[model samples]
Target chain A: MSVVDLSKQVALGIDIGGTNTKFGLVNHRGQILAKGSIPTDQYNTPEEFIDALYKEIQPLIDEHGVEKMIEGIGVGAPNANYYRGTIEQAPNLPWKGVIQFADLMTEKFGQPCKMTNDANAAALGEMMYGAARGMKDFIMITLGTGVGSGIVSGGNLIYGHDGFAGELGHTIVKPGGRKHWSTGSEGSLEAYASATGIAITAKKMRAEFPDSMLNQFPEEAINSKTVHECALKEDPVAIEVFRYTGQKLGEALANFVMFSSPEAILLFGGVIKAGDFILKPAKLHMERNLLPIFRNKVRLVFSELDEADAAILGASALVWEK
Target chain B: MSVVDLSKQVALGIDIGGTNTKFGLVNHRGQILAKGSIPTDQYNTPEEFIDALYKEIQPLIDEHGVEKMIEGIGVGAPNANYYRGTIEQAPNLPWKGVIQFADLMTEKFGQPCKMTNDANAAALGEMMYGAARGMKDFIMITLGTGVGSGIVSGGNLIYGHDGFAGELGHTIVKPGGRKHWSTGSEGSLEAYASATGIAITAKKMRAEFPDSMLNQFPEEAINSKTVHECALKEDPVAIEVFRYTGQKLGEALANFVMFSSPEAILLFGGVIKAGDFILKPAKLHMERNLLPIFRNKVRLVFSELDEADAAILGASALVWEK
Candidate 1:
């Protein structure tokens, strides 16, 4: 077989967050050659944001010149719609109301651009380059500030009727259990399974166990990472916090298994750093709750991609998706 | 276009139940031309049941003779797998182990046969001939002795990797709230939203309200139908029973909506006969629980097919599906 030069062909991936907008040039094999970021808060409008992006991204394009083939652009952001290519009323965005993000990017860069919510982009990336490779039916869950999910069924992401499916985070797992800090929803998966939720659990648990290592840190300074550090040293309070959180997460995962019967459930982002402490209880509870036919059939594992670069890689994978 | 005779074309539909096995010959317009049933209780094995079916159905085919074309066979049964075309160990059925029902049907009748769980077939029937007509993304829920569901996404039934997906009835809605008498699983949707659950609710509530009409009936005789009659007579106790059951159902529906974002959710089977008494509360609670974007978007309605014929109709629809 003739060798093909992969370095010459690249896709531009952009990840837009509440504070920062990061862009990267990625090849087909999930390699990021060049990357940069700009504060998303500086722009007053989406149009201005697109112009600023063009100004920064154009230089990177010129640096490669005619030697590289810039295939297209793929973007991942909050509240983005794949069908309409717009971001509608995202709570944390600088722009208000509906912004035609994909249209603006395509026009500014003179290339086709596709957009989807960040969780979905991460799922696509996993399908192409990460833990979910060669698997057609699975769930990609991000355990960050909020729990986010992308459900793939029969090798395709389920977009549903209005292209807003797979909001697993908001599904009530506890039923009037814990109120979400922002959405004000009661007993959602995000209210218990997220890093923010873990921190909340740590604060509550450490206060009750005064002699625990978790209590050594100041109240305001305690977080998931600090709890993980405490658990590493065999702190019972920190360990119990993860056990309870994992129990909730596992129960929710069982519900999802019953709904879609996926081949696997992949966990990603910060919460997974606790390792076996979280995974053991999660796997045990999930198996216990499922029907006998479903038990021992689903594989539960953590993501293999680096969390920092996964967003860009996933967005770029969307460019190569049919 | 030239008009064609519909009477000349027909498909065979079979619904296998615990006590009785029903079959029908249906035309393209969803009309039943011939129907019959055999006692499934008498058969010792799946092969014996297939032989009994052949003996009963051969006479109907002979009656049509050269005038009609029998296209294929479709079957709906409990614990059936679409991918494997087999019925796994269903507790209600007389068969002891896995039954290769489709293969047996194909061998005996010399026709291509497809099979799925009863609920999935109902969803297909709805899509072809009932309330879910013209809908690509929707969910079909049957509130019978037990709750059952069939999820449709992107114009296809989600059989998932294992073909054991869409077991919505078993999903835990109330977590440690109620115990399923048969499965022993606590807090499942079927534990509170089914006809069996309604009967249990009526028994518990009427015991407290001594003057209620529901107390007039014997506890063993009190079913969903009795509760409906008493509720029709403006009995507050009966009404409260449905309100509680509907509240549990509505919360479960909200969880489903968040997971799939379907265009509509169609309710079928006995419990829906309560009409607005159940519908009003289910609608209210569902909308109240949904996020802002999902609120007021999903249409919740009852199935349009006749209860007696829906099973056969849905089974026949599978023959026409691609």
Candidate 2:
């Protein structure tokens, strides 16, 4: 209600990816007022990365005349820990071992900092500004290179005891079936439902149907996008691939529904671009597998967040949580 | 803090079972000062049952001189809904349709009343007075005639969107494996880890090993208790049966851990009396099935509540929750 309060309401959100790190000055309305990026893989040490980020972001703060307005900083990174404010053993990150990310950000920016894994950030983003807004209970699932999930119950994101809960991707859906590439776990949801899994399914289907349209492209050329294009053309092999992936994803979602009874499950990321080609089977199978009490009750929807700004918005929302 | 406050601190807990409905006057310290039960099946209708219950309990209240001390009442019954405060179509209870159990109790006793399914009440009880005291997150499992579960996260019971969350028992552990008599779903945890499941396992093992000690008892006589006793006596057939059951339970628990990542999981009910016989294998398999980050981090323990008083105490704890 005061001018002083309005002047000091912005937050800085940073999303660190394997290649690039995106940063933005975000307002309480989930709007990104200013934004920039730095190459994440270039820095050999986290200290160097933080120094570069501050150098690039400092001018933006001054230009906006809102240096004092930034209340805190929130970061979303691979393998980040909310409890410890550290990123540990991220396979794709440039840094190795554990990095005290939040403490370093706080020291450099002179503000409080909080951090969590990117998927959890996305869930918070949805809860704050996306399709899940105003909803207290839901599951946010990202289907990228590998499957990832963020669980929200009773209007709060579950950080678990160790801050590494909500690993729905790693939950075994098929039992002794396909093996995960990194964890070596068999039948994980990641093994069957991720974009990588979709590509693998396309390859398998191509091999099974020798005369299929997929045969026109070499095996290496096949990806989720290519498969989607082919499926849109009514390619049987590509259509079957999506069907199989949706079936596995739907069954797993049904089990998740039983576990938490979320009001809705939101799908995000690249693979979801296939839309009803994948969603129809996913919803059908999810309902098919659910118990009678849960059938037809849970809504399955797509994320409404603008993909370009979702990460920054999600990370920035964490600052408000403090 | 004051004598009047202390006198009015007590609550009445009621646990309604198929055969017997138990009642107790309890304090905040989880102490049961006075308790009794009435046969649930003797009354033709809920109205008659409520009248009989009040008649039996009013005398105790007068004798304790705490008639005015009881602050509120809480009831735990099968199919009870926490949100709607009703019990619906309980298979074992004499009531066939949706009953306004909470409203009736409030009207009869002239006090506020709350209700939840028996398992959810047990979870609340544990959070207030049992193994889960001081814990913000945990899963409570009761392995009775069938498997039942209650989930707590952020120090609150997860009622989900429909007041029917935490149905881990029905989550499919083995897809299309064993048939659930009630839900008709196959390979549910209830079909593999429940008391009935143990008896089925015993009978199957007896059929396989004709010379086993289990064969000495008629196939109809074999039950969870009998299997535990046989395993204690070093009967290989019974021991194998427990190992198989534990393997299934542990695997299912691992999936649950990935879903919520609770601080600990507490096991209760008649089947858990086997203690190490069941726990050791369950823990081993659960740990074996978990992702490396989660392995050895979650505590698997038995419920510490006295079985005779646990249900009543759990229900009574609900009054304080309001």
Question: Candidate 2 residues B138-228, lDDT tens each?
Answer: 9999999988888988788988888888888888887778888888887889998999988988898899899888998986889998898
Given the true complex, what DockQ would model 2 score? 0.76
Residue A241 in candidate 2 has what lDDT? 93
- In the predicted model 2, the residue pairs found to clash are none
lDDT of 1 by residue, B211-275 (tens): 99998888789999999999999999999888888888899999899888899999999999988
Candidate 2, residue B230: lDDT: 87
Q: lDDT (0-100) at residue B192 of candidate 2?
A: 83
Clash totals, every prediction: 0, 0
Candidate 2 TM-score restricted to chain A: 0.97
Candidate 2 runs further than 4 Å off = A4-8, B1-8
For model 1, the stretches where C-alpha displacement exceeds 4 angstroms are A1-8, A66-68, B1-7, B66-68
